[model samples]
Target: MTPPSDPARIPGDAPDESELGRIAADLGLDIGAQHLAEYRLLIKQGLGGYSRLDELTSPPPTARHYDRDPGYLPGPDENPYHGWAWRCSIKGAPHGPLAGRRVAVKDNISVAGVPMLNGSPIMRGFIPHEDATVVTRLLNAGAEIVGKTAVPAFCADAAGLTGLEPQPSNPYDPTRLPGASSSGNAVVIVSGQADLAVGGDQGGSIRLPAAWSGCVGLKPTYGLVPYTGAFPLERTLDHVGPMAATVADCAAMLEVMAGADGLDPRQQLDLAIGSYTDMLEEDLRGLRVGVLREGFGIPGVSEPDVDAAVLAAAGTLARGGAEVMEVSVPLHSDGLSIWSAIVFQGATELVTRGDAIGANWNGHFDLDLVDFYRRAKPAHPAEFSPTVVFTVLFGTYLTEQCGHRYYVKAQNVARELGRQYAAALETVDVLLLPTAGMKATQRRTDGSIAQIVARALGNMHNTAPFDATGNPALSLPCGFSDGLPIGLMLVGRRYDDETVLRVGHAYEQLRGPLAVQPPKLADRR
Candidate 1:
């Protein structure tokens, strides 16, 4: 990289005295007119370097490394469940671990020439010029790019509701919602549209959908997989990982996707990627499973059938030679509150103020996406969904009224939460819990604002906390309730994703296949 030119002794892009006074008033500063002139001159002097920056050329965009066509959006006939955002075939390497396997890339993830809506009309015509790191890695491992799965607008809702047409529905029951914002990733997997998928999770997006749709989804240990080109919600909570029809496929995909890509700041410098597939055959002979007691019996959230199913699944794990014991971490119940405080303020700072690409971080930044988002959001404000609108409003209010105190406090609390969970994990290999307190919820198009909000965020209690702690959490199909699939979640120590997968695989072997079948696409049509 070349250094920028030296600053010239010329005033450039500095605010005038009047503008500076207004800015100071907006920020609640008490600078007098006497000091305003001095501040203006000093500001102009400080801004002189930016003139050189403006004259210098920017670095070129990442070059496209593979051949691909601009994929077309699928019509109703082809997308009965509204799972696909765009469809195309981009073949990968001739042979590798995932050769011939079709994989779905979530729309929030960039795929070079593919049009990524991200379930929001605000970004309707934008096309990514570079593939996300996960996309490139998957293609390198011989997994053919099949399609981009749909998500809730800006991936803000977990109920699969979007501002655009054809909202995603549960594969088991069309009238119900498939969990989101990895809604379509789960849909395509259960419908057999793809063999594997890459799902982004901030707060239970991957695991919630997998639970409702009967697929295996793993939110790998935070930073275990790079998030270079994905649309992020909150940086601290953002995670990209694998989802598949089975644990083996999920593990195989993780083997390819996990590893620092040098472009993501979220990954630690000393991080070591595990061989997830190699540990799948490991038995559960001495694995101690702690059934998190607080993960069950929420006042309004937990359903009897869902809890019963998860407990039964634990019993099955015990039958397979694993020690199952109930453990309580009182702080576990407060995970969602801590997550909200951080996300609300953090997202507003990064997305609303920072143009979705915050500063003060050293890593690859997609300037093209940032430029587009900056231009598009202001022009098409109404295109934002209710969920997104609420997030912005709430987050902005929090920041404006409270400053960073709440966010700072929440982060401090989150560290303690991680310590408590780590202490509990010291005696056990993994913590077992229900992925969500309930099963798939019924789709409601007409409801009060409170009802809609409740539907979108109500089921995230069990899954959100792990995101805060950066624990490797996996959701796998465990049982069925009233013909709907129930999910059992396994959480392991940080960077211990392989053990989580191994335990999930062991449980899969112990329990026979789920009895309910995926609804036929033709029947829906």
Candidate 2:
């Protein structure tokens, strides 16, 4: 086909023939000269609508309900554990459930006026214009927003080593890692910097850190908490939940955070929010607990002492009058592979290519963030952490070679995985496992790419699957191994978070308080 001698060009800049040819080459399309002109005319027609849309003003920004300051970066004395990303105090409603409690929000969640780095230099100067749904909820419930906690870059690394400055180390032992992504939240909660916290989890970010830091973390059922205003990795697997020093505190936070906010397509409109704190009073009497056999004794990954400690914790549930039995869901062992494929590909598309806010979702999009990242990332690609670089490279390779075939297959398999867990949940109210296969590992100053990647993901085997399946899983300090905390995980049926918390609270009562002391901080007074 031949084009008309002169094409009707849009007033603004449009792709010329040379640029079009390059795009065609990139897409592997063979367009002869004659056809190229015809395609160019068609492309110009498409740009006309975009040009019209560009002239319109954006919708009004969400109104800020509470006052807050542009928080400051704390010094060594103020942030001894390096757990804080930024510090400021935003008091909420004068009276409510959390009236006087202090809360640390993971840096990934937006707090309107505060700088949110999301634990990466690439996002350095970006300040959100609106609060994340969870943040707003926390404020409405009368909690004080004390500061932003650190996270691994893009919340990708599990070791907590690959992010912005002031990376958090374990409160129990500064030489070891606290855990990743939600690393600083755990440290702050355990060290008494904050009474509670909000943490995001795609693949065990909340639970792993809470486990290693001897605190309580809950990855509420996917979409139970609206993810609006937070930097998302993958839509399907994204979750934001509560982390605290005790199960009761976690429940109280969840009570405030859970509910549909009219934004965030991730949340279902009809989903009912529960009174999570009330469930804490319920004993574990007659509750059936399944100790997942596959969750322990990984040939190379699980440490013997860690396994023994978790098994002992499960026995404590038995002594609390719950019926305990061994149950095996062999597919549980395959969760990591499934989660890896989804996160690697999905995050690459959503975060790297889509600029942290992907397309095809009906939710409040933070255009400012999208614009900032689009400009910043290209200018400083070298500043991205190792995990970010690997995901981009590997995901791009998979997309170029196999397309979304692997991701699709993994999603399909993930549904089966969910079914397998559901079938197990049919008989038992909760499933028990080691939150992490081993205790906190020593921080390595240097290593090969393989070693670094392994250290980042090695502890996620048992916890990652539940994220993929969208089940409510809680991790609490079960015991101590080699002076580090060992986490016991309790996973319940979808939306049955109350039952999970009930069990965890009952077990906490029987086990007594964790013997580990908070890391002594330099006195600020």
Candidate 3:
């Protein structure tokens, strides 16, 4: 909590040689007794102002939405398939666009007075004192914050099966992964438990689950929705979006969710956001849909059925008066490598520095978060899932051996990739591809670390790039592959989320409603 460059204001008693020796050693300093005394004097003086940070307090909420005190309930196990962090019934405004809509908030996003597990055992008892921007917006719009849903540890898994609770099962088929990190968001919606869900996407968390769950998910342009209070992974890549059973519902949510809060530094002052639901139209007349020429060339990566379904979706749009064409942006193929260097390297820096880059953008942050990480991380490293452990290790290694130069290079190249996409967009309204090249992979009960990591990393090739390039991308059910839902990915230019949603709505009209319903919903209804 200490300010980065505050000068020492007062002196404290010098530490003893033994204490100094241990502290120095912990920092990789090997000071002998001879030099320890002088170092201790200097260190004690330098730390004199450290107590100033303790006087600071956590930020208070701007508004309270719960109609009644949110009492803690036993983790309800009504349906074992419905995995939630906690269950509570609460309502918001009596009349608004989302009134009467039941919604599930992802664990990583804060809800005032609620325990924010972030899908990690280490964060079990941590409670956020304020709501995330999205939560406040949703509450103001009259949506009930029904419960907190499950997520993979820190929302790190590519497959939805590893975290603090049982991974939310696929409503369609329990044997398959529902989707990555935002797994519960998709599952709860598909199961009829909630009408809409809030989800955050670093790579493909939002879309992956929507695809696998036979629903709609939108990862708006990187900063369109302020991430003022969400726990961050990589600041530049983090996105909070909506997931629902229909494109119109996703649009209605986005109408309230998007806009400049003047808090998230990621948001552009000149960015234009409008009523998204108003943009949804039944016809896509004269719109051009570009099929990325190189998106499906990877042999082992692209499954035949998945590819065919996306192409068929493109054809469906073509039949509905949209011009469909193939356009090549060769740099698209390099997305994974570039995304890896930036995300891993950036992630290492975020965790190691004990601070987030944009934490103060809103003039408030969960200072307890830093303290919690400080106390829990070293003490409970085992609490992280294998995928998160791998990411941390890989990131730490990259920072140590390669230094941050590679991260800088990756960021630089990412700008160029964005330009390439921008150029391609000038020729087409949106780019079409499979949200992921493959369909939902099988869920394993207890797999080896390698298998878990592989499962988490399997479906990121197509989606991760848009996260890096800051483009608006939406995934909606186009059809099913071997009975599992397949998603057609529609990507629009940065800040052009309305176009992407419009195209998706148009496509849905052409394809009609997808009939693949998860069996789990039958019993509940």
lDDT (Cα, tens digit) per residue for candidate 1, span 369-420: 8877777777786677777777789988887888889999999999999999
Instruction: Tell how far residue 105 is off in model 1, in angstroms.
Output: 0.7
TM-score for each candidate, following the candidate numbering: 0.95, 0.96, 0.91
Q: What C-alpha lDDT values do all the predictions have?
A: 0.88, 0.89, 0.82
Candidate 2's C-alpha lDDT? 0.89
Tell me each candidate's RMSD, in Å, in order: 4.1, 4.9, 4.1
lDDT of 3 by residue, 382-483 (tens): 677887778889988877787788899999999999999999999999999988888888887456888888888778899898889999999999899688
State residue 61's C-alpha deviation in candidate 2, in Å: 1.8
Residue 486 of model 1, lDDT score: 94
Q: In model 3, which residue pairs have backbone atoms overlapping below 3 Å?
A: none
How big is the positional error of residue 114 in model 1, measured in Å on the Cα after superposition?
1.4
Clashes of each: 0, 0, 0
Q: Which number leads on lDDT?
A: 2
Of candidates 2 and 1, the better by lDDT = 2
In TM-score terms, candidate 1 sits at 0.95
Q: Give the Å shift of residue 393 in candidate 1.
A: 2.0
1 versus 3: better TM-score goes to: 1
lDDT for 161 (candidate 3): 62
